[model samples]
Target: MTAVVHPAALPADLRAATIRTRVTVPLRFPDGYSTSAEVMTFHGLADGREHLLLALGGWEQVLLDGAAAPLVRVHSECMTGDVFGSERCDCGPQLREAVEDITATGGFLLYLRQEGRGIGLYSKLDAYALQDQGLDTYDANLALGHGEDERDYAAAAQMLRAVGAARVRLLSNNPDKAAQLTALGIDIEEQVATGVHLSEANSRYLAAKRDRTGHTLQLSRAGVVRPAKAAAGKAPGHSGMLARVDALVPGLRARAEEAEQLRRLPAVTVQELQDAGVFRILAPAGVGGYGLGAQSYGEAVRVLARGCASTAWTAGHLTEHAWMLARWPREVQEEVFANGHMPLAAATSAPVGSARKVPGGYAISGHWSFASGVMHSQWALLAVQLDGVRLQALVPNADLQLLDAWHTDGLRGTGSNDLRADGLFVPGHRMMDWAQLTGPDNPGSLLHRDPLIHAPMTTLLNLVAPAVAVGSAEYALDLFRHQLLMHKERNGSFVRQADSVLAQARYARAAGAVSTAQLHWQAALSLLPSEGQADAGLPEAQRAPFRLSLALAAEAAQEAVRLAAGGSGGSMHRLSHPLQRIQRDVGVLLNHPTLGIDPILEQAGRGLLGLELTMRSF
Candidate 1:
C-alpha cells in the first residue's frame, strides 16, 4: 500500500511563505453528522483499508459544520507519521483523527499541506530515507542544508481568513501551532487536543518532536492515552512492568516453592492466574479461564521478573505456552476441559525426538529436557516428529519417564530436567505442529497468533535459563551491600569491603552491569506480544541479533556475579554463603549456549553484516 502524506500548514506567518501549500480550501460542516463522511481525500492519500496501511497512515478529512459553532481545525500535516505513520512519531494520527472528530461533531477542517516541518515533501521524503540509514531528522535535514521547521504558515491564515473563519476552537496538541494562528489575527477561541496517541510505532517520534524539534506539547498526557478499545482478555499484570511484577510476586513465590518441593503449583496459585469461571487462561471468563492479556499479560511478566527473575522467567515461558494452548478453538478447549483443568508442562527447548505420521495422527517418540516444575504436571507436551513434522503432542505424564537429570549448577530450585517419551500415541486432534502457530490453519492461530511460537527455539530457550542469572546477580548485589554495611558497623568503620576504593568501584561496576543485563532480559520478555501473534517466531533475520542481545545480557550477569563474588574475597567460597550459591548459579548459567557470549556475538555480527549464520555445534 502507498504511504499517505498529509501535511500541516506552515506557522501563521510562513504559511505558504516557502514551500507550496496545497490548494487553499474552505470546509463546510453539517451539524449532527454521524462521523461517517468517512474520509475525504486529497488527490494523493493512500487507501486506509489495508491493516498495515491503517496502522501506518493517518486518516483523511472532509469539511464539516457544527451545531453550536463552526468546527475549525488546525489541519496541519506531518512528514514523519502522516507520510510513514512511523511508530516513532504521531503526526499522522494528529492530522487524520482531527478530521474524523470534527466530521463527527459537524465541523469544518482546514487541510494544511505542510510536509517535514515545512521543508517541503521531496526534502522531507529525502530526510526519511536518510533516517532509515540511522540519521535523526535534524542531521538528515542538515545533510540537505534545510533549516529545522522550514514551514510557512501565512498561507493557512490567509486561507482561513478568506473562508471567513473569524474565530476557531483550533484542534491541536502543539501550543506553537495554536499560538501562531492566534497571533496571526485568527482568533483561536479555544484549543482542542488533536495529537496522535502513542504506540510502539511513534514513541521515539513523539519524544523527538517534544525534545529535539522544539514542538510544544503536553507530553505527560500522551503517556496516558490508551487504545480506543483493548483486546478481549488482558492479564492483571498488563498495566505496567512494575505493576505486573508486583502483582505476580505472590504467584512466583508459590511456583518457586512448588518447584523447590518437587510438585505442581498449588490449586490457589493456578487459580490466581485464571480469572473467574475459566478452567485455564484460554477459556473465556464464562468458560473457567481468566482471559487476561487480551490486555495485561505482558506487564505481568515484567514486574514478576523484578521480584524474582527465576519465577518471572518460568512464568513468562509457561504463561506464553499456556496462552498458545488455550487459544485452540473453543470446541477443542471444551473437549480438553471435559477432563477438567489439566496440568501440562512444556519443554522450553525442542526435544530430541521424532514423529512418524500414522493413520489418526503420528506416533511420537522423544525426550525433552528442562521441563521445570514438571513433577506435579499431569501431562507432558513433547515436541516430537510426527510424519516428519515438529509437533507438540500432549501425552500422559505417566507415559513419559522423568530422567531426573536436573542436576544443574544453578537454579537448583527450578527442578528442570529431562522427560522421556519412548513411544507415545497421540490422536490427530491431540497433536499440533510448531508451524501451525503461524499458519492460517489451527483454530488457535486464527483466534490468537502468538509471536512467541515463531521465536527461534534457541533464543527463547536461553531466556528460560538466564533468569537464574538475573536472580543470582540481583541477590548477590543485595548481599554485597548488606554485608558491607554489617561489616562496617561491626568494625566501626565508614567502609567495609568498600573501604578500599577498588572494592567500592567493583561493587558499583557490578551493580550497574547487572542492572543493565537485568533490564535487557526484561525488555526482551516485555516485547513479546501480550497475546502471542503469528510472528512470535522471530524471523530468521532477527534471530541472530536477538541471540547477540541474549549473549550481552548473559555476559553482563556473569561479570556482575564475578565482581561481587571475588569482591567478597575468600569469604564467599564457603558453601553456606549466599554469594557462593550465586556464584555457582551464575557460572552454570553462562554455559548455556544462549548465555554464552562468543557464539551469540558471532551470530549477531553475521546478522548485522548480512552474512550467513551457520549453526555451530554445541
Candidate 2:
C-alpha cells in the first residue's frame, strides 16, 4: 500500500509520497509504433524529485489480484540522447523499445528526472567534451569529479509504492538498477535482458557500459527478434537450426547444475534436444535432416555452449555421429534409418579395439573411452583394428555393456564414459574401413551428394572444441562483469568491483582475449567449404593450417577464462558459483586430444616446412 520505509530509518516529519494526478496520452514514435499511456504524477517524494510513471496496458488490474509481477523499466532522463537522434548513446532506442514492450506486457515506465546519470545537464556535456579527449564514459565522469554513476532509486521506489507496485520483472541490462531497487524493498521476480541496440558510433560506449558497469549487452546479438522462418517441415536449413537452438538456451542454462550433479545429461535435456531437431542439424535431407555444413554446425555449437558446455559437447558429438553414420554402406544406412527417424548414435574415433573375421561378420572386443551421448544413444560406432586395418564397427547398443567410469572435473554432463564389448559379433555390413569412410567417395556422399558429407573428418570435428571454448568463455565474462557490479560484501554493502582500476583492466584484457578467440574461430570456419559448394576434400596442407587455427582459438579462449577467474576473488571458487564450474569445464575442454596445443603447433610447423604429417588424424 505505501512506501516500505524501514523502522526508524526515515525522519518522523518526512512526508509520504502519493500519486497526485493521472492523464491519458497517445504516443507515436519515429518508427511509427503507437501506444497510449496513463501518465501519473507523484507528490511528496522524499527528495522532492519530479518523477512520473507511464502506466501502460492493464497494469492496475494485474496488480489488483497479485497474479503476476508486472514488467517495469526504471529509466533515467537523457535530454540529448532521448529527445534527439543521438548515436553516441543507445538511450533513444532503449526508451522507444521500453515503451513498446511495456505496453504489450502491461507495466509501467518509471521516468525519473535524473539526467546524465544524475549529473546536471551542463555537467554531462562537459563530460562529453572530456570523452572527446579519449576518455571513456566512466572516466569522463570521474574526470569531472562525479561518480561513475550517481543516480539512486529512492525516489523511483517511492513512486512505485505509491502506485501499489511492490514487485516487478525488471526490464533492464544494468545490474546496478536491480541491486538498488532490490535494496530499496522491491521484489524483482526476474531481470529480463533487453535487445542490444548497437551502432557504429556507440560501440565503444556500449562496451564501456558492459565492462565497467556490468551491463548485459551482447554485441553479438545486435538486434531484436527477427521474422520467423517457414514452418518446420519446409527444410528451413542452417538458419532454422540457429533459431531453434537459440530458443532452447534458457532451459539448457537452467539445467546446467542438474546435469553436473547427475554426472550425465539429464533425460529431459536429451528429450528437449530431440524435440528441437538438434540431432538432425548435420543429417542429410534425404533422411529428413537439415543437411547443413561445417560453418552452420560450428555456429550452432557455439550458441548451445553458452547455455551449458556438457549439453553442447554431448549434443554436438551426437549430431556429428549422425553425419558419420551416413558414411556407412547403403545397406547399413537403410538398417539404421529404416524407422524414418534420425538415429541417435555415439562414436569414439580412438582405435583401441580388436576384431576377428567371422563367416558373415566380425567378432569385436574392446574397451572404448569417451563415448559421449552413449547413455541416450541407440547405436555406437567403435574404432577397431582388423588385420592391421583401421575400421569403425557399428554395433547396436544392446550388444555392449556401459561402464560407470565417467567421473571427471568438467563437462561431466557429457556422459563420456567407457563401453565394453566382449567378443560381440557385428554384421559385415556394419563395418566400415576408416580410410574409405573419410575419403572423398564415401557412400553417403555418393548417395546424398551433399558437400557436408565430403568434408574431411578432422576438419569438421575440430570445429566443436573451439566453439565450446569461445562460448563458455563468453558466458564467464558476462557472469564476471555482473558480479563485479552486483555481488554483495559480507556486511551487506555492494562490492562494486567495477569501480576498481585493477578489475576494469582485467575485464578489458579478458574481453580482448574472447574477441581474439572469436576471430580465430571464424577464420577456421571460413576455410571450410560452404554448404552449397561441392567439397573435393581438403588437402593435407590446408587441413593442418585449419587445425592450427582451431587450436589457437581454444588456447585464447582458455586464457580469457583463466584471466577472469584469476581476477575473481576467493568467493568465486565456491562450488555453488557458476564461474568455478565454467572454469573447470573449459579446463577439461582444452585438454581434449584434438585441441592439444603442442601437437597442433608441431603439425602446423611441419606443414609450413613441407614435411609429412606426423599425426594420423592430421
Query: Where does candidate 1 have its weakest 10-residue lDDT segment?
Result: 49-58
**Model 2: per-residue Cα lDDT at residue 31:** 88
RMSD of 1: 21.4
What is every candidate's alpha-carbon RMSD to the true fold? 21.4, 10.4
Q: What is the C-alpha lDDT profile of model 2 across 389-419, one tens digit per residue? A: 9999999888899998999999988988889
Regions of model 1 farther than 4 Å from truth: 1-234, 240-244, 247-310, 327-332, 337-343, 348-351, 356-361, 438-442, 449-462, 466-468, 487-495, 518-543, 569-577, 612-618
Candidate 2, residue 139: the lDDT equals 85
- What are the TM-scores, per candidate, against the unseen true structure? 0.51, 0.63
Best by TM-score: 2
Clashes of each: 71, 0
lDDT tens per residue, model 1, 1-618: 111112353233333221222333333334332233322322212111100100011122222232244456655466556665565556656656665666555545655566566677778767765554335567678777887655544445555554355566677666666666665566777777665465533433554566674565543334322222222244322233234235544334323423333333444333433322112333333333454432244334434443344444455556545545554566556665454453345554454578776788767677688786565455666766545566667666777778878765555655567887655667777776666642435565444434332333333345545555665577678767765544322333333555778877888998998888877766566544455344345556766755665566667877887888777756567543557655765676677655667766777788779887787421
